[model samples]
Target: MSEQAPAGWYPDGSGSERYWDGAAWTAHVRAPQPAPPAPPTDEAANVFSKLGTAVKKAASDKKASKDEALRLHEERAVAAGRLVTSGIFGTSTIEIYEHGFVRVAPGGERYAEAEKITKKTPYERLRSIAFGVPEAERAHDTEGPGSPIEGAVMQAMSGIVRGGKLLTKGTAVGIAATGVAHLASNSARKSNLVIATDKTIHTLTNQKHNGFIQVSQKEHNAVAVALVEAGNAVLGIEPVAVAQPSISAPPDAAPPAQISVAAVAVTPSLSDRIRELSELHREGILSDDEFSAAKGKLLAGL
Candidate 1:
């Protein structure tokens, strides 16, 4: 009515087009308002929270697995039974006897359970059960043809116990006796005469006098195989050899000669002596003739 507009459109005061329905202008032609900022959905929030929890759990699991593996490796290392101390100075071996009651020291005390002595100890208390008098009683007996315990004790004391070298007959006998003592203790199931030489290891299996002497080469390659096959039979472990090389000399032999080494003072080098002499001459500390004589002497010595 005021000025009349075009039939299909209405003119807004801003000079932009407006849609006109039959009755009124419509706002469809105006720029649309930005959509309201969307709120986070419950599903999306839950997914993010779960992802964070899963990451934390995976890290915890990895840490636990690593810790468990380390514990198992330590356990296995302990069970393998490596030598703790070299039985060089004096041996502390376990003894098992024939009666099934294990005794640590012969005729001393009987242990109701072997596990009580074997388990949870830093050093293994070896048990052997064979026919022999108590270590204490054996010490008092006189050795020679008539004494059984004396003969055995003397045999055990015959070698280089520290170096593992059994270089003499006495040492060999001593090793055999020790083996028997081990067999006679509470841990031993049977006895054997075990012998180790430089080239071979021999075992007289069974308790029979002069039983089967099984032989094997003393090479590193065969140690495991031999040990496993021999088992707890006195032949299983490496036997200390008889000290066949003999620690004591024969009656006619003389004592070894002692050797002595004397230390000498180091002389100056020829070049150093010449330089010193030259400097002395230049400083008037030495005459030219004296320097020449010293230089000649040093050169000749060199």
Candidate 2:
């Protein structure tokens, strides 16, 4: 019989024990247990973590840019005093007035005739005198002061009865020469006030034929304020509620799964092999028979 081995030692190395000399097991063999699989390193973890962070940052940046654009548009609209409603024209820093006058007849006789005139019998007698009898019968027998109805009819037709004048005035509120120039050019034909900016000044000067009123800075501001107030007053008839910007949902997070590096690695496929063989054949590197054989193999594998 073989001598008994030490207690801690196992035959053929299949136990977690060590051999000690003299006082303990002297010669022992034990199978080494494999090390636990290493935990992923920080660098590898950071790659995927950083990718997720970048996706979030990019979404935030896009939202910020959109918000900034919207803010700028609102600022421009407010500065320009643009109407909130569609199809309504915006107010400007200009003032416009139109005036006209109408006059009756020359003297008291026309006034008396007008006073006697009624809606039912409006100049009926005058109409009969003018169109009743034949032209020959209507002739005046006597000359001078008592001419038969000719002078009375002529008097009735003259003065403000058939003629009138229209007057228009346009004034620009606090504006520079450039502003005046713009007003003169663009609105020459129509009577209205226009606001001036650097872009419009040259056009205004070029079209100086239009009449315009140029006001001091203070007056311009006052006129602009007045116009804005007037517009607001009209708006007061039906309250205009400003629409608030819509709230946007937060962007979705990136996918949780990591993209495997192997997927993106370029490897030659069947098509690439065929193309390489075709190129080699064209360059006379392979004979037609070799090319055909290689191409057949590639197609067969496919």
Candidate 3:
């Protein structure tokens, strides 16, 4: 259209900013910059007093719209990497992206409104995975009724007492009976697999109390492990044997490169570490005291 007007920072049809170089598009690209800060306004000057109110209102609306758009964009990006599951209660999806992972509730929607949490750096996120399994919690029948014997006894007693009334009390009676059988079968464990990320803990399960639909422990573990591996792969994390730098070199040769264990340890830089700790604090990962302690430690390292 109109010969592209000798392009100089024109829209590139993609969200990212690309250089047109006045002829052909260049390889250089950058994420769109944040909207410019609102210009300072002064109403007391009286010259622009009348328009100040209108300008302020427009600015407020624009800021809100921009914020919502940013939030949605982030949510979608995080959700794109999600791992699907056949959870019963509410389908839960966990996604591990480069910066972090997001576990959204239900099968769809992708948490468009949920905040997009970011990890400080890929190294720290991968480190968490390498360390061990994350914390987990699940819904299990801690105290439903009693043992199978009690359930059977109750079932019999209820049947005898209610007799024809069993039709109306059937559901309640059935639940008790099932609980008893469930406990007796040594199936008191939870079906859900909850795994923690740097920012969030995600739960996935097929435990609907429906006998027909059950996720075996092996399957559950597979999903969790797969998620971890997939995330690690996405972040380019893998185990590698490190060759020790030669301690001795020719007299005139450059000193053998010393492989500092601490330096070799992959972690975010000091600023990134601080930012991560801040995020953890915001997400309730670290209590006030814990955050303070961890922050102090990081600072001390510096």
Candidate 4:
């Protein structure tokens, strides 16, 4: 109207471009186009890729160094202080040190190419340590059938007590059952060295039956030697020996046989695993947080 405007594309308020024919708006139009994205450079991609590779390489290198260091350290560990664990989980070792210990998982001893690993725990975290039989073994020992003839004979004799009126048929049956159970449990006794820390409990058990009915005092003393070493390392004192409590006979019944596990013999000691971890830590293969985390996880398992 005031002057003929130049024919060109212009914004149409709806945000698309429209062609002005100098007299009126034209149907020719298009939505506003976005600028093309900048091309990704090889340098940027390479930076991240190289970084990842470097991280992996570093980890690999550290692992190799750690295993080498552990192997060397293990060579110097006291034979008595080096305890082995061989059971359902496989073979492992626990190397006890003055301040702490190492738990080397199965195959961890293969330095420079080990898939198994080690964890470290400070003795300061140790809560309690004792020698005893684990419930699993006790359950195993009591799983067999007892002497049926003995049970029946015992049952008959029990019925004769107190003019045959002291017990019901059910009571006689119970006594026979108890006698049978006792017979089954007389298989053998093995000891375990149980160490409990803030995070978990570690049990090192005897690999074989140390006795027929009960582990001998000599065997107990053998395990106690290892226990004393652990006690000194953790508690900084000696543990007192406590006598097993005797079960008294009931006034109306015969005295029931008791099985005591106090000072039971253990299979072996385990202290090498933590020692290996300490070796790695001292050599800077693992950092403080890494060592602590590894130790906590290892102990959390059996």
Best by lDDT: 4
Candidate achieving higher lDDT, 2 or 4: 4
TM-score quality measure for candidate 1: 0.20
Model 2, TM vs. native: 0.17
The positional error of residue 168 in candidate 1, measured at the CA in angstroms, is 58
The C-alpha lDDT values of all candidates are 0.35, 0.32, 0.44, 0.46
Q: Which should have the higher TM-score, number 3 or number 4?
A: 3
Model 3: lDDT equals 0.44
Name the better of 1 and 2 by TM-score: 1
For candidate 1, the 10 contiguous residues with the lowest summed lDDT are 84-93
Clash totals in order: 38, 6, 0, 18
In model 2, what is the error at residue 190, expressed in angstroms?
A: 25
Question: How high is the lDDT of residue 102 in model 1?
Answer: 18
Q: Candidate 2: where is the Cα deviation over 4 Å?
A: 1-39, 84-302
Arrange candidates, best lDDT first: 4, 3, 1, 2
lDDT of 3 by residue, 140-184 (tens): 433245532224334434554565223224434444555434422
lDDT of 1: 0.35
Model 3, residue pairs in steric clash: none
Pick the TM-score winner: 3
